[model samples]
Target: MRFCMMESKGKRGVAASRDGGPWHVLFESEPGFPGTVDEIVRSGEGAFEEAMSAIEAGTAINPDDLKFLPPLTEAGKILCVGLNYKAHVQEGGMPMPTYPTVFARFNTGLIGHNQPLVRPTSSEQLDYESELAVIIGKKARHVSPERALECVVGYSIFNDGSIRDVQMRTPQWTIGKNFDGTGGFGPYLVTADELPPGCKGLRMVGRLNGEVVQETNLSDMIFDVATLISLLSEAMTLEPGDVIVTGTPSGVGISFKPPKLLKPGDMFEIEIERIGTLCNLVVDEK
Candidate 1:
């Protein structure tokens, strides 16, 4: 089942849409959809049983009645894997990594799909990265690749907005990628069972305006999702609501022949097959 957080009556709730219309509220703050999403995840195979019941009773909310929010409002931390895609490495003039390259983003960077990505006046090297983000359903550490799937709650899309100038200023990329509102993750979370095995063959595409700019398949990932999870768990504990952003494909601004960065007023969209599209507009920093 797809799960999202949306605004209804000035409060946030879990919802789903139908026919590309407004959001339908499934669970609210008092009822706590985040808690419900967690409870459903823990329920394993029976997670959607209640939602099904609601549908049968004709009490389910319609999709066209709510406003969207980041899929998870309160993940403990956002863990990101970089350079996992071979094409991205090639474009950046870097060699493929032997182990997963990791980084961290504070929750302050989090923003919802369709939200605005602020273009900082301090830097003019804005870029977009379309990636698949994995949400953890349970606490995990030192997990084996064989069992890592059990800790995943679902998958969502993330646009890892970057400022190449800031990123290249220092060897570390934290400052460039973690600016406020740079991280766009949401639309909804699609459960693991709902997705194909290992997310192999999935297509991730990014568009600037309506023109396709970056396109790649999950098959091109040097280190697939399962291995990344296992590798990460060995070093840090992955908690329920924790997020992991799989790396982006090539075609980022910084990799261009002369580097084409995003200016204020540009729009970007990241689409992952079987998940959903996350679209955001770039705006000048206030």
Candidate 2:
């Protein structure tokens, strides 16, 4: 089942669709209705099952009537992987990592589909990164790669927008990655069972305006989904609603000799096979 969190009549609700079919909206006031996507995920499998059943019987609403919101508005943790693709690493002149190079993105930076990606006035080096996001379903600690997929409940798309100048100013990337409203996180959260295991063999693409900028196959990752999850769990407990943004492949703006950085009025899109496209308009930070 594909799940989308939305707002209507000034109230928050959830819409569920089967393979991009008709969408059924379940408002928060309904009986047995779960809370926000963040709360539902943290509530565990029983809540998801309940939400599925409730949403299935809800009122069918026109897509345009709802305001889209990130699949998880209050994600407990947003851990991001960096340079997990060979070409991305090579382009940045970084050595292939024995372990996933990880970073953290705060919820403050997140925006939902159709939202504007804010380009801060501090710099004009804003860049786009196309990546697949993994949503955790259960608590995991020291999980093995073979069993790591079991902890994933669903998948989503993430555009890890970056401020390259701020990012390069420090060896640690958190400062640059956490700018307000820079990360594009949603449109829908496709359940794990709906896609191939580990999303392997799927194509990931990024576009600036209508022109394709970044494209790659998911199989090219230096560390696959299961491996990243397992490796991450070894250091910290993975909780439900925790998102792991699998690293982007090559073709980011900075990789070019003359960067293809974003500016106000530019539109960016991140698309993954089987998952829907997440498009955001670029606007200068007010």
Candidate 3:
């Protein structure tokens, strides 16, 4: 199933569906019901079954005219990986690491579909990294590679927007990647069962102002979703709503001859197979 937390008719809106097109509402701020998409996810399969019932009997909403909120609730954690794609690592003039280069992005930095990515006044080096993001549905720790995928609930698109200058200030990339409102993460969460195992062989494309700037088959990743999940689980417990942002492939703005960073009035888009598009605009800081 796919889920989106939105605002409709001045109230909290929740929409979910197993297939495509029109989505049915599970909750529009109904009393004593799951009030948010994350809550519905946290409710596990029981809530999903109930939502399916509504899909068959409830009024549906078209994708248009719905305002999207970041799909995550207060309990989510965004764990990102860097340079996991072989081509991307080569473009950056770096040797392949034996392990995934991991990083973190605060949930506060994320914006939903159609939202603007605030370009901080300090730098015009904002760049886009198109990625596939996984949302974990169950608690998992010390999971093995063979079974890591069992913990995933759904998949979504992400633009790991970066401030290049700050990102290279030191070895640490945390500050550069955490600028408020730079990351784009939501609007649709397609459940795991809706996709092939680990989303392998899917095409991921990144667009800048309607032009394709980056494109790669997700199979190019050095470490696939299952491996990353297994490795990450070794240290921390993965819980419901926890997000894993699989790294982007080659053709990022910074990889160009002169570096094609984003500017005011520019738009960025990340689209993946099975999942939907995640689009955002960039605006100059006031």
Candidate 4:
């Protein structure tokens, strides 16, 4: 099943897609998509089931009629896993991690697919990292890897936008990565059931304009989703609406023969099997 955020009547809402139209209103306020989904999921697993039923019964409008929002909004915390892809580590001249390397980005960096990514004047080394993003459906802490899958609501595409020069200026990546709208995530959230078990062999590809730039499979992950979540939960509570970006594959601009960076008018698209593609354009900051 696919779920998306959209705007209608000057208000943003969460919506489900069926027969090319939005069915079942999941949310009704701007920035409330994730929060609304969390409420439903918490109320019971049957909540979504009931919504689907209503849609099938023609009680909801079709999807083609609404404006879309990023599948997730208002996540309590946006957790990012770094160097989880073998190729990405090697390209960045970093050694394979013995443990999950993690970081965090604030909500200000969050943006939806197809939205314009504004280039910051502070840095000219903008780059893109295509990643598989995970959305949490339940509160979890100190969970076992075997049980971690139970907490995942679904997956989506994420462009871990970065400013390479600023990022490398310091060991921490926060400053370079937290620019407004720099992090592009989501077009829709695909339920875990829609993905294959283990997700180890799914294909993920990144393109600049129309050219394929990064390509790899989940099999290349140094720390798979389940283990990463289990490890993180050990450190802090993972709540509903929290997000985990599972790192990127190789081929970021910084790894080019001569580094390349995003400039105004650049476009990028990331496609992950089962989750759909996320496309965005770059524009100069106003």
Q: lDDT per residue, candidate 2, 40-60, as tens digits?
A: 788887777787777888898
Off by over 4 Å in 2: none
lDDT of 3 by residue, 1-286 (tens): 7877777667767777766756766456464345576776788766766766554455577755777877775546789999999989999999998999999999788888888988899998899999999998888899999999999988888989999999999899999999988988876888888898889999999999999999999988999999999999998999988899999999999999888899988999888987888999999878
lDDT of 1: 0.77
lDDT of 4 by residue, 1-286 (tens): 7777767677666667544444666444422234345455454455655555543443376655666566767788889988887878988889889998788988778788778887887778889999998888888999999999898877888999998878878888888888887999888887777787547789999999789999998878888889988999999999877889999888998899787678888899999987789888998778
Candidate 1 C-alpha lDDT tens digits along 1-286 = 6777666677655665433444445455343243445445555555555653442332256544456678776677788888988878988889779988888887788788778988887877779999988888777899998898888878999989998778888877799888988888877888777787667889989998878889999878888888888999898898877888888988987777777677777889999898889989998889
Worst 10 residues of 4 by lDDT: 26-35
Residue 137, candidate 1: how far off, in angstroms?
1.3
Superior candidate under lDDT, 2 versus 3? 2
lDDT of residue 72 for candidate 1: 74
List residue ranges in candidate 1 displaced over 4 A.
17-23, 27-65
lDDT for 70 (candidate 3): 77
Question: For model 3, what is the error of residue 52's alpha carbon versus the real structure, in angstroms, after optimal superposition?
Answer: 3.7
- Predictions: Cα RMSD each: 3.0, 1.3, 1.7, 3.0
Q: Best-fitting candidate, measured by TM-score?
A: 2
Assess the local accuracy of residue 54 in candidate 3 as a C-alpha lDDT between 0 and 100: 57
Which pairs of residues clash in candidate 4, taking residues 3 or more apart in a chain or in different chains? 5-69, 6-67, 6-68, 6-69, 7-67, 21-62, 21-63, 22-62, 22-63
